[model samples]
Target chain A: MNAIEIKNLNKSYQNGLKALENINLSVKKGEIFALLGPNGAGKSTLINIICGITKKSSGQIRVFGRDNEADYKKTRSMIGLVPQEIATDSFERVINTLRFSRGLFNKPSSDRYLDSVLNSLELSHKKSNQIRTLSGGMKRRVMIAKALSHEPNILFLDEPTAGVDVALRKTLWSYLNNLKKQGVTIFLTTHYIEEAENIADRIGVINNGKIIIIEYKKKLLKKFGEKKLIFTINRKNKSINTINSIIKKYELKQKGNKITFNYTQNSKKDPASDLLSELNKRSIRFQDLEIKKNNLEEIFINLVQK
Target chain B: MNIRGIKAIYNFEMSRTFRTITQSIASPVLSTILYFIVFGSAIGSRINDIDGLNYSSFLVPGLVMLTILNQSISNSSFGIYFPKFSGTIYEILSAPISPFEITCGYVLAAASKSVLVGIIILATSSFFIELSIIHPFWMIFLLILISLTFSLFGFIIGIWADDFQKIQLIPSFIITPLTFLGGSFYSINMLPEFWQKVSYFNPIVYLVSAFRWSFYGNSDVNIKISIFAIFFFLGLCLVLISMIFRSGYKIKT
Candidate 1:
C-alpha cells in the first residue's frame, strides 16, 4: 500500500476561495515525491490538509493505509513538516526547541539524538543561541533540525530552500537526500526545477488547484519533453532559404538567419536526419549545430498554460 | 490530550519565558512600586480605609491581582502573537504537536509569568504597607487560579488576534477598563447604588474580592459567589479554547 493515499481531495476557504479541487495522488513508501506548482497553485494547502493542519472540505486521505481522521494521532506521529516559511520562536534556543519538538511527538528525550540532528543540520554550534540572533539561513536549518528531531517516517519540506543561498541550498538538498536514504518518504514542494529534477523520483505538477499530471520523472520527460535543434550557418547562403522552405514543408518555424525544429520521441519521422539530409542536398553550410532537451521548467510552463 | 507532550511544551515555554530575568522580574517590580507610590502613598493615603483596612493595605490584593491579570494576558498574548507574526507559528502548527498541547504550553507559560509577577509585587508591597496573608494557602490558591484563568483568556485572545495591534487591544480596551472599574482602587460601596449594582457584573470584581477576602478575611462580595464566578469564567475560557483547538480555528485554517 502507498504511504500516503489522497483521493478526490477538495478544499475551500470560508472566504469562498477554492484552494484545491479534485486532487488524487498516492506516494510510495521511501520515494521522493516533488509537488511542483506556481505561487498560488494550492501546494501548501494540500500539504496542510494531509498533515491535518487545515481542514479539508472533501477528501479521503490515508496515511500508512489508516484513515487520517480516524487515526489522527497515529497519522500525525508518522509525519514531520518543514514549513515554507521559517518558524522558530525567536526566544527559543535551538537545542531546547528541538528537544521540545521531540517531546511533542511523545518521543523519549534523547540528548544524543538531538545533538546528532543539530549537527547534521550544522546547528550544534549555535544550539544555545536564541533563534532571533541567527541569520535567515541558520534559522532555516534550525527549522529542519526541529522537524527531524522526532524522527518521523514521512517528512514534508515545503519550499525548504526558497530564500536560501546557493551553498546552503545544496547542503540542505544533500541532507534531505540522506534522509530519503534512511527509508523516510519525502514529499517536497518547490519552485526550483533543478532541485526536483535532481532529487525527485516522481513529479506531480499542480496548477489552478488541480493536479495536471503525475508520473515517473524520467517517463514524463521522455513522453512530453521536447528537443530543439538549432543550426548557425557559416554564410548567408541561398541554400538557407531552401532549408527554410524544407522546414516549412515539415511544419516548422523559421525566422531571419535561424530555423528551429521541435520534435518529440513519437514523431512520425526523425526530424534531425531529415533536416541534415535536406541541408546536405541544398549544400547549406553551417558553422555549428546544437540540440537541447527541454527542462522541467519548460514542461511545467507548457502544462500550466494548457 | 497527551500528558508528555503538554509537559514538554510547558517546559520549553517556561524556560523561554524566564530567560530574560531582568525584564521578567525587574520591570514588573518597578511598575508595582510606581503604583504603590502614586496610588497607595499619594492617592490612597488621602482616601479613607474600606472594610477596616488601610488604603495601601486594601490596594495590595487588588494591585497583586492587577499585575497577575495584566502580565498573564500580555505574556500569553505576546507568546502566541510573536510566533504568528514571525511565521514561527507555522512551524509549531506543522509539527506533530496537537493544538491542545500547544495551548497548554503557552497558557502554562503565561500563568507562570503571572504568578511570578504577582509574587514579586506582593513582596514589594511588604516594604510600603503592612501586607498580611490571612490564609497563606488560600492566598496562593487564589493567585494561581486567577493567573491561570487570565492566561487562558489571553491565549484565546492571542489566537483570535491577527496582528500586534489586535493583541494589545484586549489589554488596553478590555482588561484595563474592566480592572479599573472592578474596584481595584476603591470599594463597590463607594459608588452610588446604581453603579454598585453594575459593578457586580464585571468578572474582575469577583477575582479581586475573592483575593482580598483571602488576604484580609473580609470582602465586599460573598466569598462563595466570587469563587463560583472565577471557576465559572475559567470553565468558560477552557471550553472556548478547547473548541477553538478542536475546530482548528485560526491556527490551522
Candidate 2:
C-alpha cells in the first residue's frame, strides 16, 4: 500500500491567496520522497494539511488506503512530524518529554523502546536534563525523538537542515538513512537541491504551488542532465554568422571565441564527434575543448526558472 | 476521549508551573500578603466596621477573589501563549488529540494553580483577620467557579494574542483596574449613588459580591443574578473558545 496519496489538493487562504492548486502525489511505502521547492512554494502547506495541522480548502487525502480525516487517530498515529522550527521549550527533562509524547498517542510505556530512541539519537546522556538548557542541535534532535517516540511508520521532516550546521546535517542524514533501512517510509521537504539529490529515492520539484516535476531521482537526473562540449577556438577571421548558421540545428551558445553545444548523452548517436568533424571540414581550428554535464543544481535551477 | 493526550499536556503544563514556582505561585501570594499588611492593618484602624463585619475580616473574601482573578488570568494566558510563541503549539495541533482535549489539559492546569494560590492566600490571611463563614459549601463553589471561569477566559486571551506584549495587555489594562473597582476592598454602599451604579457595570463586582455573600449572607445584588453572571461569562468564553477551534483561528493555517 502507498504510504500517502493526495489528489486534487487545493488550499486557498482567507486573504484570497491560493497557496496550492491541483496537487496530486503518491508516496510509496519505504521510499524516501523529497519535495523540493523554493520558500512559500506550498511545500510546508502540503505537509501541514496532510498532518491535519492546517485545513485544506478541498482535496482527497488517504493514508495507507484509509481516508486521512475519517481515521484521524489511526492515520495520525501512523505518521510523525518534525516541524521546521526548533520549538522544544518544555521545562521538563528530556526523557519525560519523550515519554509524554509517546503517551500522547496512548502508546503503553516501554522503557526499552524509549532508551533505544534516546540512545540512537545520542540523547541518552541528557535524559535527565531539562530541555531549556540543551543546545540548539540537541533540541532539534529532541524534536525528532518526540516525533519518533510514538513509533510511527511514516515520518515527515520539514526542512530538517534549514539552519543547521554541516556536521549536524550529516548526522541527521545518517540517522534518517538508518531509519529508512529499518523499513520506515520518509517524506522530507527541502529547498536545498543537493539534500534531495543525496537522500531521496524520488524527487518532486514544486514551483509556485505546482508540481512541475516528479520522478525517480535517477530518471530525473538522466533526463535533465545533458552533456555539453565547448570549443575555445583561437580568435580569428571566421564569419560568426556562418558558424552560427552551421550549428543552427544544434542547441548552442556563443560567447566571444568560445562556442558551446549541448547533446543528450543517452542519444543514439554522439553529436560531439560529429560537430568536431563538421568543424574540421570547415577548417575551423580549436585551441582547447571541454565537456560539461548538467548537474542536479543546474537542472533544479532550470526547472524552477521555468 | 483522548485521555492520554490530555494527561501528557496536563503533566507538561503542570511541571512548568512547578519549575517557575517562585514566579507563578510565590510572587502573587507574597504580593497578596503585602496587600493584607497595608490594607488590613493600616486601613483597618481608620474604619473599624463596614457591612456589619470588621474591616480586616471583611477584606478576606475580597482579597482571595482578587488574587484568583489576577493569578488565574496571568498563569493561563502565559501558559498557552508561550507554547504558541515558541511554535511548540504545532505539536499539540498535529497530535491525534481533539481541540476539546487540549482545552481541558491547559485550562484545568491553569485553574488548579490559581485555585491553589487563592487557597494559600486565604490561609495566610487567616493569621491576621478574624474570619467568619455563613455558607461554607457556597463559598467553596464560588471559589472554584471563579477560578475555572477566569482561567478559561485567560485561555481565550492567550489564543487571541499573537505577540509577547499582547499577552499582558488584557490582564494589566482591563482586569486589574476592574478588580480594584469591583468592590473588592470596600462595599459599594460606601460610594455615592452614581459611583455605585458605575461599580455595578464592572463584571468582577458580581464575582466578589457573590463570594462575600457566601461569607456574610449579604450581597449588593441578588445572589441568583451573580451566579447567572458567572455562568453567562463562562458560557461566552466557552463559545468563543469553541469558535476558535472550529474556525482554526490563528492556529491551523
Q: Pick the candidate with the highest TM-score.
A: 1
Error of 2 at A233 (Å): 11
Residue-level lDDT of model 1, residues B100-132, one tens digit each, is 778878888889888988887888999998778
User: Candidates' lDDT values, in order?
Assistant: 0.86, 0.88
Candidate 1 lDDT over residue span A1-306, tens digit each? 899999999999889999999999999999999999999999999998898778899989999998888788888889988888886777777788888888878888999999998888888899899888999999988888888888899999999899999999889888888999999999999999999998999999999899999999999888788989877766667655676677778676666556677877555757788778878888888777889899998998899899
Per-candidate DockQ values are 0.51, 0.61
lDDT of 2 by residue, A1-306 (tens): 899999999999889999999999999999999999889999999999999988999989999988888888888888899999888875778999888888787787787999999999999999999998898889889999999999999999999888788998989989999999998999999977778888999999998889999999999998988788988876784766657766686767888878888887666777788888888887777899999878778888989998
Query: What's the TM-score of chain A alone for every prediction?
Result: 0.94, 0.89
Q: TM-score of predicted model 2?
A: 0.90
DockQ of 1: 0.51
- What stretches of model 1 exceed 4 Å from their correct place? A230-249, A252-260, A266-289, B42-47
